[model samples]
Target: MPSRTPSSALYKVAFLWNLFWGVPLLLAPSLASSALGLPQPAPGLGELHARAGGLAIVLFGWVYLTIGGNPRAFRPFLPIAIVAKAAFFLLVAFVCFFHRELLAMLATAVGDLAFGALFYRDWRAVR
Candidate 1:
């Protein structure tokens, strides 16, 4: 087994962060919404959409876990992961700009932003 680097540790943290949001959102959308300080969505379509989003987050966490397990082998994914994190932050920021009530999501946005920056740093170091 290869020794873990700080970058690998960061990917593990990212995986955990995604789980923090993903699992609850997947299992209980209304509860997750309330926890995140957002209005609870109606059942059916609203809940379905929320669940879908949760699934996507979980998928991303899987990618992070893979990278964390073997950063050198997953080198090509580093840039893609950074972009995915940036895109998520930007999307959340855009939505929050128009809807102040959604500001609670800022923490998640910021988390992605920080992870993106850290990933960029690691990518630079390797190159």
Candidate 2:
């Protein structure tokens, strides 16, 4: 098993990083989008989409928080979440590459990939 300290530190970083996105997203999706330079949705469907996305992110963030506290307890979730993060990064990157206006959102893609790598490393180290 990997030393608990290094793995734990990675998990803590993951937890905090997820929180950084979750809080703003759940509280104010528009502001979060603005900060990321992502395009805002229109008042009707756009706003609804943003809000819904925010809710989803909050739920995912909760999962990250849970796992960070006890990776072994939540070991089963590790692979799935790691893959999801990787997919998210790829999806965002693809979308941004096609849409110039969404280029700023690439920052999140980069962050997501980094976190996914760290999460994978920590999870694998245990075995």
Candidate 3:
């Protein structure tokens, strides 16, 4: 059997990362909401974000499974994911140091950086 390629490994990493990060957000919406420092979602918005986040977590898991099975399909989204991850980390870092949020934004920054690195590695494999 052929050895797993770099892109394939990267996809596995990305899938795992997204699935792991999304789980907490889906399972504990109030905790997530507290970390973000937003007012408690109004009844309608409560349902909206919870449902959306739950759906997103499911989708992320599905996408991860798909990519793990076939890494080539991840090509198109790699660059965009990397950029978004980087931007997210930067924002988190800013908030962690300057905004004084309840939950340490540093964790978010660390996660974003890890995901960004994985995406970047996959992008390079394609080039």
Return the top candidate by TM-score: 1
Global lDDT scores for all candidate models: 0.88, 0.76, 0.65
Across residues 1-127, which tens digit of lDDT does each residue of candidate 2 receive?
4365325666666667767777776677778878887766677788777778777766777787778777888878888778978998999888878898987778877898988887787687554
**Candidate 1 similarity to native, TM-score:** 0.91
Q: Which stretches of candidate 1 lie over 4 Å from their true place?
A: 1-6
Task: Work out the TM-score per prediction.
Answer: 0.91, 0.83, 0.65
Model 1 / residue 14 / CA error / Å = 0.7
1 or 3, greater by TM-score = 1
| lDDT by residue (tens digit), candidate 1, 12-102 | 8999999998999999999999988898877899999999999999999889889878777787999998999999999999999999999
The number of the candidate with the highest lDDT is 1
Candidate 3 ranges with C-alpha deviation above 4 Å: 1-4, 7-9, 32-43, 50-54, 57-61
Clashing pairs in model 3?
none
Q: How would you order the candidates by lDDT, starting with the best?
A: 1, 2, 3
Point out the worst 10-residue segment of candidate 1 by lDDT: 1-10
TM-score of candidate 3 against the unseen true structure: 0.65
lDDT of 2 at 37: 76
Residue 52 CA displacement from its true place in model 3, Å: 2.6
